[model samples]
Target: MHPTTPRIAIVGGGLGGLTLARVLQVNGIEATLYEADINRHIRLGQGGTLDMHAESGQHALHEAGLDAEFRAAARPEGQDMKLFDKHGTLLSEQATDEDDMDRPEIDRGVLRDILLDSVNPDSIQWGKYLKDASPLTGGQHALHFADGTATTCDLLVGADGAWSHVRPLVTAAEPDHSGVNFVELSITDVDRTHPAIAELVGRGSLYALGDNKGIMTQRNGDGRIRTYVAFRAREDWLTMYGIPFDRPDVARTVILGYFSDWAPELTDLIRYCDDTMLPRPIMQLPVGLTWASKPGVTLIGDAAHLMSPFAGAGANLAMRDAVELAQAVTENPGNLPAAIETYEKALHAYVLPVAEIASHHLDLMISPDGDKQMLALLKQFDAMAAQGSGGDR
Candidate 1:
């Protein structure tokens, strides 16, 4: 720890926390990052390509001095977005590379690795789940971990995701079901085993939509494709289905049963899926999620504004928050509340609009009036592409 620098504690070593740590390190500030997982390798890292906008994700990476490393691993081919109908009819296509699209595709796992490598080796403290955290005198806070360790810091930032333990201290916000749950699947060794799926994903993303359901898939860097069997249902639907959400065999049956009539190639995405089936029920904190200012503590990333994945804004927004927060601290040294106030003031404007767009996209995707709404989205993207603005800025 730098003797004159701030002592910051970042909970949850996801993309957001990792990025914040890197940003702070580049500026000569030290941060201790706590993650719940036993270790980094415990993750399957199956989430699809995040379309990181130029001004958001890319900009944050640049600020962290990770642009070169990020580019080496970025999948420009993953920038392509393709839409299909339930009957396997192709409706739309859009493509980009490293030069044109700022939001180049990179596996979530790969991105985390690059960010993790940028930080100090000892900076991240894994296996520490948040048991509780509280404010102490002299603008410090005590953080208690589930593993019987305790630490305190002058500044605490919750970069943890949806179910953040630190959130209750700032606001009463919590996540509610978003009426959509994704049963995630992966066709590993796509080039060797699942050539059909490899082709279907077409170097990037595939969105096949139908009545109250969709199949979202994306090409991973490792010749594998991460896919999701998305369903629109009431919050209790999965519970009533009696499907073992964690087990692959059971979840696969529940998923394939829903799309029973789909083509063999498509349903094969479920059959050939690996054992790590993730039943990710979408949840979100209320948009415009904010609270009264408090000294020495704040939130970033999903801990701050958790919305649906529809808008593809989660990672970008979270990375952006890290950058803004770092800038805030740099500009207002020794004035903790002033720095936090600066962060929230800028964050509200940046996050609120994106969250609204995300919520709206999720609502439209799951609504009774679906197909046309999807077509409209396709058309909107086409129009943007036509104007030479596919992913510019």
Candidate 2:
């Protein structure tokens, strides 16, 4: 697919985009990245701890030669997970001891920092939010940006996420909303600022459940913790609930009101939480989200298959796609057509099961009546805990 080098442009600066750029560079292929954000540091990138799986997410990091850096940011103790009822009774536990566990935890922001540091700054062009792109001539495409800037590329890759601009080049599809709407809020410096909430949350992931509502919280690095308060609602409920979308205090109030029936220890997170409340409407592409061929354009990560975070495989699957696509290009020396075909074929087969698992799990997590689903998770957690002490091991 190249005479020494391919004039490639990668759209997006998320994990999958950076992984592709880093891995391709390792193989001596140069690719430029276009990002929508103003700059890396300006983007907070804050969130919960991502449990980097052994064979998928971690393997991709190793392939990119960023494993040592990843370890530097890993929090082994954060892999410990707990499930509980609305009344705050412990149902089960996993990764209890945190020893011999391979799936280490890292804050989303820290993980992004490691990926960004691995790549040369010159490789990324920030604030290039794309509005439109078109095929030019002889394997080239012109990119039109929101800022009215333009550039051309010999090969374009879409790592832009679920709402990818590059996806339409290959297929006709978009992300559909998953049933759950997540009201995400955070508690800063839990060990110091909010000791009671920290005690309620402990050292790992927390799942407090009821029939239709639930809360998932996890301790993040630097004495901070992020919590997702989940509710099953129509797509428009976020606005209907008067969640001040931008102000943290307004969002905090809206989310707290949902769980007003619960204990003060649980609802206290809202009162003491940082005001940055954001409504996350869970969305995903089709389960078997595959697209037909078009020249010089392909996708990875959420852009390819954005599923619910139920099975916790969104990042894992995206990393898998990057590795597979890279191998396809690296393997097929001459025929670009053959390379893309092979990559797409393999990706379709590989992602279907995970997508199905993701869909099924989303249903359980956001069901109209979630009790049966909560019971299922409790049973699974107990089973896993009985088999192994901590999720880390």
Candidate 3:
């Protein structure tokens, strides 16, 4: 190691942070990662499958030299999607074959594990939750951890998610609720235990929207089906509506009551959910969010621009940001501040348009006529496909 190699510290062990670390490693730049989880297993069931975009997520993997590994674990079948209305009437479906590798899907946990395995294990310090970062002399920052430990790094990267502890250092913006919340439920062993749901979900995902509400389901790699009952409601609807999600049967009944007028096949999703349920409020930072370049400090991913999932660009953009930042650091070995400034300049330019599109999609998808609008959008996509110009879904 060079004696003056920048002492880099990354907060958050998500795909963005891990990708940054891996990319830096490939370029012979060492960085230490601080993760909140005790170990990898803590994130085993964190999120659903992710469809890595060719231009972003997969590009980062290629930069990190994990393209072959990603291909081995990627699922082309998971790209299939079925769109329906509340009446269980299928509006449009996108069927994918084994060779459709443009946007292959991989379980979130699996991708994280693959990245973790590739990075130097000793470089990652697990169980270290960031408390705060204080600017110091000489363009460095002091990172204070919740466990009463501290470290000083010449370059500090906040790859943390929406509720980032590091975001306050660079930006004052906070994540605002998008007037939508997801009540998550799951059916384990869907293939054997719930054949009907397994068939309905197919190999990928299903979206059934109507009456300003939606029932969305995604099939997981472990024969589990994760479902989200989306509601365009107040932030406290879960408590105020008296869903009693703690009790499995009662919660299922109450949840189904809201969708009683919908088709029976759609209601079956909520009825068969396992006892575990989680209420997650959709939140996003103001679109076109940008912060002045703080010397020795910067942010990426949700820490920078938190947006709704309707655009399906969150993870993709995160990994893209990671790659660009890593390249910037590698290019300016003698001047980190310059590298950070260049990265932020390019980042703001790139994320603003994507964020605007995501915000627009969120509004349209959760509106009262979401099903109708979504159907129309799918029709346009079908037309594009027919013309052989549908590059990516």
Top candidate by TM-score: 3
User: Over the stretch 1-393, how does candidate 1's per-residue lDDT look in tens digits?
Assistant: 122467899999988999999998888778899999988889756366676678889999999998898888887778788877766777778776647555688878888889888899799898999998999876678999999999988889999888999888889889998889887778878888877777777888887777788888888887778887788986777767777866768777877888887766767778888887767789999988778878788999999999989888899989999999998887765777788899998888878888888888877766554555777977886689789887322
TM-score of each: 0.93, 0.92, 0.96
Q: What is the full ranking by lDDT, best candidate first? A: 3, 1, 2
Q: How many backbone clashes does candidate 2 have?
A: 7
CA RMSD, predictions in order:
2.5, 2.8, 1.9
Question: Candidates' lDDT values, in order?
Answer: 0.82, 0.79, 0.89
Model 1 off-target regions past 4 Å? 1-4, 245-250, 385-393
Off by over 4 Å in 2: 1-4, 245-253, 368-372, 381-393
On lDDT, the stronger of 2 and 3 is 3
Q: Write the residue-wise lDDT of candidate 3 on 1-393 in tens digits.
A: 112589999999999999999999999999999999988787647688888989899999999999999999999999899988888898888899998988888988889889999999999999999999999987889999999999999999999898999899898999998899999899999999989889999999999987889898888887889998999988888878888877878988988999998988888889888899888888999988888898888898999999988778899899999999999999986788889999999999989888887877767777787888888877877789899897333
Q: What is the lDDT of residue 33 in candidate 3?
A: 98
Quick one: best lDDT, which candidate?
Answer: 3
Q: Which candidate do you rate higher for TM-score, 1 or 3?
A: 3
Rank by TM-score, descending?
3, 1, 2
Tens-place lDDT per residue, model 2, 1-393, is: 445356778999988898888888877777899999989977775567788888788999988898889877887888777776666667667665555346777887888888888888899999999997888766578999999999987678899998899988888888887777887878788888878889878878877777578788889886888888888887778877688877776667767787777766667766787877778888889888777766677888888888888778778778777788777777763555667788889888978888887788667766544545767765765678888853321
